[model samples]
Target: MKAFSHERAPDGKNEWLTPPEIVQALGPFDLDPCAPINRPWPTAARHFTAEDNGLIKPWEGRVWLNPPYGQETIKWMRRMREHRNGIALIFARTETRTFHECVWGVADAILWIRGRLTFFNVDGTRPKSTGGAPSVLIAYGRENAGRLHLCGLQGRITPA
Candidate 1:
């Protein structure tokens, strides 16, 4: 079960981290837009699947997430909050107060993707599409999002 672990080393070839992946690796995506998954509609590791929905349920342990890039982001963020154990990778849109409250306000950490990502479709197939927007990885509670070290990626929001 090879999930989309964002820990690719820089060994050249297809191992180079794209901007969206980079942002996910970063944390507290506070300065960019969310990147859409690359490809058309259903790639193996890009888009959401029935398997994902099943796995990300209201479990009382660590979790994974790659939410869809739409108005429903807030819904997904809320779901993560309910779980208490979550690591959600989603697009970063500063304008969304709902997103900010659920993800940025409550989340423990945030990663800003440096580039775009082409999300996959539902059938685990790559879509013929690309997104130029940046993205973010929002971690719910205090835990690792994808088994990656949070080091400098740790972030917090202080009231002004």
Candidate 2:
């Protein structure tokens, strides 16, 4: 199988890192199941990186996922749906198959972020530019759903 890594190279592609503020907005989670080797922000004490085959690993507890942006997103979203706990950061592509199959009705809450996010660079520094697309935060558990409601994120929140 191809390596479905999260960190986009310095190749000027759109492998945007989840902004630190966005991660902080949801508060702390128990595991970042699809993190890079050196994460830009702290999401969880435990992480299952792409090298560890996070897609195949058993995911439990409050999870946080900023999954790889392409087809790999389907797999991570599926797992998040199965785990049914924690928050996931993904593009707000409601028309995509991944969103309909894994997110639409599965998430407990959907937070439509107010604007495009600025991702961190591969070296873990703040990027000078904002992301190419709008983002959404999805909560799978009631705790996260409540957190999404009161987390003070600049977005519109709707119950799923």
Candidate 3:
């Protein structure tokens, strides 16, 4: 299967890295609470990997979260909502309960990426195929919402 497919990783891991260009466009973020441990590039000034259990850590500054997919995503989204000062990259599963609970009316804005993203590997290599699903950038604060509005990415931004 293609590495970018979120269904299941060929490497038997779910720790896909976010494309650096996307991060660069929306940064500079102070923290990446769900960063991969062996990333080839820095997503933020500070990072918390799986071992760090970022959900319980003290989150400060503007966060850049590409949280773990699947069931655990809700927890990260909840945390982001509470932090109320950051951005989150997740699959555009608009009908999911997580979206209703943590995003939607709760977030400051939403940017629907024009096309599916091809995520990077932990080693920073590009994938051969694009992701199985579309993605969205959720802005939690006014500054982040403004960043989404003018990030220059090909996407439609909706303010809440």
Candidate lDDT values, in order = 0.46, 0.79, 0.88
User: Residue-wise lDDT of candidate 1 within 96-156, one digit each (tens)?
Assistant: 7657578655766666644556643323344444443455666565545443344444333
Cα lDDT of model 2 by residue, 42-114, tens digit: 6787888768988898887899888887867898898989899989898787888988888878889999999
TM-score of each: 0.52, 0.88, 0.94
**TM-score, cand. 1:** 0.52
Of the two candidates 1 and 2, the one with more favorable lDDT, higher being better, is 2
TM-score-wise, the better of 1 and 3 is: 3
Q: Comparing candidate 2 with candidate 3, which one achieves the higher TM-score?
A: 3
- Taking all chains together, the TM-score of candidate 3 against the true structure is 0.94
Predicted structure with the largest lDDT when compared to the true one:
3
Task: Output the number of the TM-score-best candidate.
Answer: 3
RMSD of each: 11.3, 4.3, 2.5
Off by over 4 Å in 1: 1-57, 145-160
The residue pairs found clashing in candidate 2 are none
Question: Model 2, stretches more than 4 Å misplaced?
Answer: 1-15
